[model samples]
Target: MTSTLTRLPRPYQSYVYAYPHKTAYRPLAPRPTLHEVWAGEPRDPLSLYLHIPFCEIRCGFCNLFTRVGAPGDLTTRYLDALTRQAETVRACLGTEHSPRFANAAFGGGTPTFLEAGELIRLCDIAERVMGADLDAIGFSVETSPATATTDRLAVLAGRGATRISLGVQSFDENESRAAVRPQRRADVETALARIRDTAVDVLNIDLIYGIDGQTPASWRYSLDAALAWQPEEIYLYPLYVRPLTGLSRRDRAAADLAWDEQRLRLYREGRDHLLTQGYEQQSMRMFRRIDAPAPGPDDYSCQTDGMIGLGCGARSYTRNLHYSFDYAVSAQEVRAIIDSYTATTDFDRAVVGRAIDADEARRRHLLQSILQADGLPVADYRARFGTEPHTDFPVELARLAERGWLADTGPARLRLSPEGLAYSDAIGPEFFSTAVRAAMAEYELR
Candidate 1:
């Protein structure tokens, strides 16, 4: 059994590590400034992402670009740099064009770690630079239970934040302690209550199963606890070990940490329980209210290269190219990365295309379609790519159908069965190239 597991395909190995921690990427050398990459469509829809890379304390499992320091005036300086980056992005994307900045997301170690006033300033700068009204934008912010206080909630509300994703990894005290993320359940409830009456219309709770002390029974209780909160969205993620993270070292040194199968079982059990509680499974890890806005059918995961990321270790993608800046290296490097943004550059289109292969795109569409209670729309796919979904990938789709993983809801529409939806993560990368597969394998080793 061990040898079989060791010899598993690269896609399977990669999928196992898809669980959450923090964003992982390398920084670009001799940081360049934002410049005009290939001009996107004149009226292309753009999303604004603000990276607030500051954390009170780093989680043992996190590999995100965040640091521990409450240096005086740090928030002010970070916001200033972010504003400059936004300005550069506005110029590069074309100022005169009213590109639809449909959504805005604030993510990081913990956005609420910054003073409320700092967050407001960042929002003000974003609105002024993007020329987009805050009321119409789909703004979301991520907060940790320890930092989200009544005051912070009020500041976020005032800034027109629409969604609040609370990092409530687990309600179990032991599990929380083991994860090195101690939070009072009451504090999280209070934060949720404060956001409930505010402009933050969506409350998404993030839960982590498959932790060191986690089991199916324990995870079941966690789900029940989460459902009691009645969050608009729930993201159930498995625990993953990353190199250099505090948790990885502990797990390695501990004589008896949880095994891989235990983690997998926890995920499977938790997912099944969530579906039973009336939440609609959206992506691989996200479950939303039945009526929430369904994510787009496009390969958004691979298309996230052009986003203008701010803060420490944030990455951006433009014209199918990827670039990142690291704040953890040094204050000078961080500032240099921000100032290096210019008006033009070469992007990795081929890499982007490879990242979101046809199989991956199809899997994303199918998973989202099922989550939305709709089947894949043949006409839309035809309209977007001038080809039918089945025509482009009949071999795989037909095989899945034969295995009862897919169902023909209509002439050109197919829906994933519950079983297929459960396997969505495993199914997405079945068509990656050998080279891509090898790269994924190497990533796993790191």
Candidate 2:
């Protein structure tokens, strides 16, 4: 169905963080038990993800499943619900055939939004109930400048968080405000100092390009500011104003082509700047220092293994399906889902998600690999799927090659050129399955 003599489409359609977005999911008919859903899947150590939905403020360009604030003991109630869900999930996985976890992560509006004591309790649930050794597993946590408190970070370090990602969209105060993320440069520096005081081994700084008033010079200032910390990893994200986000209310990008061109220019600038500073491109968004800390015992790859997610906003992925509770961006729907999750006691069923069939699996493998800097290994793909990627998706490959997106580095691997990686946000959607496209199209926004 994907056939056309190719011409380049607009780059930056969307960020393909995961194949088949959450919007593609639906309520499961004859809801399957967690056991049935995971049965026959590889019991190899899986990645554990815990989602916390509260944040001090939502970024203007963010469409994540998180809410603005937690009122009157709501966080405590949420953690209680998390504990209950963990207990149930642990019981379902059972003693005889339970899946072992290799690593863990805490993500959301901001996980460090919890107080030091509350953070300890959250760690306890992960360690005691979920059977994940945080110290040994090298867990990661996400935080914002406003919430990266010394007490909370100390607790995280003491409990074994190896990595902490601080979302400081821009060090330029004006650019920060333009992005609807209110914070002073002084506050951001203070937060960075607090994070460095902790024992965390790897620090990832998140920055964005394409803010409303961002210029090349202003963009370089933020990049240089982030480098001042010499973080282990850095992510330069292009600003995408998704539906229902604060930026989406107004027409921020009246001229789509101009916006895309601006983003591309900034992206190339950021990529080149990092490279010169001894960082290696891990993907379109991620760059790692050449001397970054070596992998620990808990090194887990998201491409191959399954993920067991806790909290209302998280999703659990098995080889056969990806399941999660209802997803939302609007504050009202998000609060409603969290309320329902906290009140519910039955946690054994796979209520809503999409089933991944054979074809979808191949596409996922292809998408995940090709988007990275290393690109896809042809031998690996053939061995895994018993078919060459080119043979299976001739039209897709043709379209990509026609655009000069594919490099002539040889047939040993299916790799995207530098320009291809630049166009990743566009290239990713080119491989989405027709069924998934339909499902996403039909999903109604709240």
**lDDT tens digits, residues 312-402, model 1?**
4455545433445423333344345434332113322111112334544444444445433355677766665567777767776776777
RMSD of 1: 5.8
> Tens digit of lDDT per residue, candidate 2, span 1-446?
33121235778887899977999999999899987887777766788999999999988989998898899999999999999999988887878876778889999878998999999999999999999988887799999988999889999999999999999989999888888888999999999999998958999999999998899999999999999999999999999888889989976654477788888899999999999999999899999999999646644566668999999999998888999999988989999999999898889998899998889999999999989988998998898889999999999989989888887868899888889899999999999999999999999998
Point out where model 2 deviates above 4 Å.
1-7, 253-255, 297-299
Reference-based TM-score, model 2: 0.97
Question: What is the TM-score of each predicted model, taking all chains together?
Answer: 0.77, 0.97
Q: Model 2: which ten-residue window has the lowest total lDDT?
A: 1-10
The list of candidate 1 runs beyond 4 A from truth reads: 1-12, 15-35, 38-42, 197-199, 251-260, 291-308, 317-319, 326-376, 388-404, 408-411, 438-446
